[model samples]
Target: MDTNETTATTLQTKQHFEVLDGLRGVAALAVVTFHFMEWVYTDSSKNFIGHGFLAVDFFFCLSGFVIGYAYDDRISKMGILNFLVSRIIRLHPLVVAGSILGLLAFLFDPFGGHPELYSTGKIILTFFCSIFLIPLPVIADRGFNLFSFNAPAWSLFWEYIANIVYAFVLYRIGRSYLLLLTILSALAICYIGYRSGNLLGGWSGPTFWDGSVRISFSFLAGLLIYRSNWIIKNKLSFIGLSILLLLAFIMPSSKWNWLSEPLVVLFYFPILIALGAGATLTPVWKKICVFSGKISYPLYMTHYAVLWMFGNYYTSHKPGTTQLVLIVIAGLILLVGFAYLVMVIYDIPLRKYLSNKRNERLAKQKAGLI
Candidate 1:
């Protein structure tokens, strides 16, 4: 293979690692605990589990970095249309499947007849908005909220929007300018927090934007790390991962998890660095990391529903310790099962097809066959 061909091949290898998958498992489990623990145990009991939502932040960083690393070159070369098509193929199928499940969930009222829970109007709105991967406009008076149909779908909206922003705005800017834009984005988030009177825009500033700031910044960091070819090639991913874990442990006790914001941002830097450096590292850590990464998405998407199921059961039956332990164990089993289904039936096939298509198209373009 020529130099360019060899480079592409290497990148493909990075894309296929098990560590990223393992991280997915970890992220998903965190979300599960975040959602269900409160139901099984009181808030005081949930002290250990309450922070599961932060896993989404980790996910955002991972998504941004991984997507950027995977697609920056193609996006830079092929333009947004190609990028959108690829994204749609990669993300939309599962999204549609999830939406259908959400609709069924709403109709059945799996969350319960808290008539205040979901509205038909909000359900319809969330379905379409989520379908298009856009944030539905907030209709505060309507009782139905972004958490209406599929609460998790909201994040996907941010993910898609961030992808669009990257393609049109960040990716085109020179690397130095991209770094500047990232800093500005983080500051923008903080400013929005102050103005909205909530660090996460409590009820003001659009919900979609709630996580966009972090997503954009972390993603840009990933791209920069990749372009620089710095830590990954130097066997520093282990160091980076260590620092991130240490920071997460130490950073949360401050006022309001006040340190959480910056600490998370700090934590992701090393993760992106490590992932970008995937090519050169053969650390034993690679095995564990990749496993978590692969299941992360399914773990993420399915965990909420799993938690909800457990909560529903617990609320009605009020089981004891054995049952609760069984519930947790069952939830983990369910997550694994669901992740396998998603990976085998949904994620893997679709990803392979889209990638293969991209490769074939690139080959044809090289040969002027188009």
Candidate 2:
């Protein structure tokens, strides 16, 4: 009702960085392709898009930048509980859907060869845990990794952790202290990469610390980018930037150049986000950016379930290279379609419902109608 309230509301709903949104979509697609390549090659070293896993790093950076942009100042108005609830509403719908799909896949293909995982009890436990976006411990006999239902959900678990850190810790810290934390995280990422020869082991039991380092560094880098308001006012197109991102992700890792992944996460991605934030887009490009960003999270969250089912069939059939290419192309199309469907039918609607409920509750509270 007042000027301050009006200003806060405007900041909350400000227009996003279109190029960054499109880039997020680009990274998500690369991740899907990367998973397919993993299925085809079966050897991590031989996969063409071996660096695609870095897309998760990219997502972390983007998330940090966006969260800072959207919430760094507004946290005073919204409070930590409101911010956490907002994040849950934004992210948890697709998580539940992905877990349900994983459960169904496990049911229909109960004998997909992992005998320990076929038990109904484990499947139900996994489903329930996944609904809450909780990462389960890896039970080797049950084929359970960090997240049994959806493997990629491990990253989301870490993302939520980062969000918590942001609200309670990072957001309140002064810029100098935040920079110190970021530097320390970067050093840790470099150390981990140097030891492992690549930024690879973040998704499973043995390397959960690696995952923490990866998210912490990149997410802080993103926050720094936002806080510094770094930007490049060049005429860089989203298309060009998107292509560059694809190349970055698909680039092969070299044993001789073990520092590449860490360098990209520590330095390159933050620059990319800054440039993306600064760049301008045409009307058509803006539409593409909106569409791509809309589908990015859904695609990331849901595609793994489809891959789980397809991986079994592909392994048994052992298709030739040509057939594999076609299958991959078809799979990409199907993934896009399926992600769009989930976005339309579930994600958007559920978020709207939750958002409305929250608003109504807030209004009632204001009117002393608790």
The TM-score leader among the candidates is 2
Expressed as tens digits, the lDDT of each residue in 1-370 for candidate 1 is 6333655676767646444455556557656655666676564223455455555566666676667677766665566787777777777766766665555554554544343555767657766875665555444421234544445766777777777877787667777887787677677655654454333321123554556665666666666665655444434454454444434423333344444455456455445446544634465877766656666665555444444445666877788888787878777877777777877897788878877787788788878999
TM-score of 2: 0.94
Q: All candidates' TM-scores?
A: 0.75, 0.94
Per-candidate Cα RMSD to the true structure, in Å, reads 4.8, 2.2
Taken over the whole model, the C-alpha lDDT of each candidate is 0.59, 0.84
Candidate of highest lDDT: 2
- Tens-place lDDT per residue, model 2, 1-370, is 7323554577768976889989999999999999888878766668888889899999999999999988887787778898899899989998899888776665566325463544667667767888887677644532456777788888999999999999899999988888999999998988998888888777877787888998999899899888888877778899888877877787766774368888888888888898899889999999999899989999999988777767787878888989999989999999999999999998999998998898778777878999
Q: Candidate 1, which segments miss by more than 4 Å at Cα?
A: 1-10, 13-21, 38-46, 109-111, 114-125, 137-147, 189-208, 232-254, 267-291, 350-370
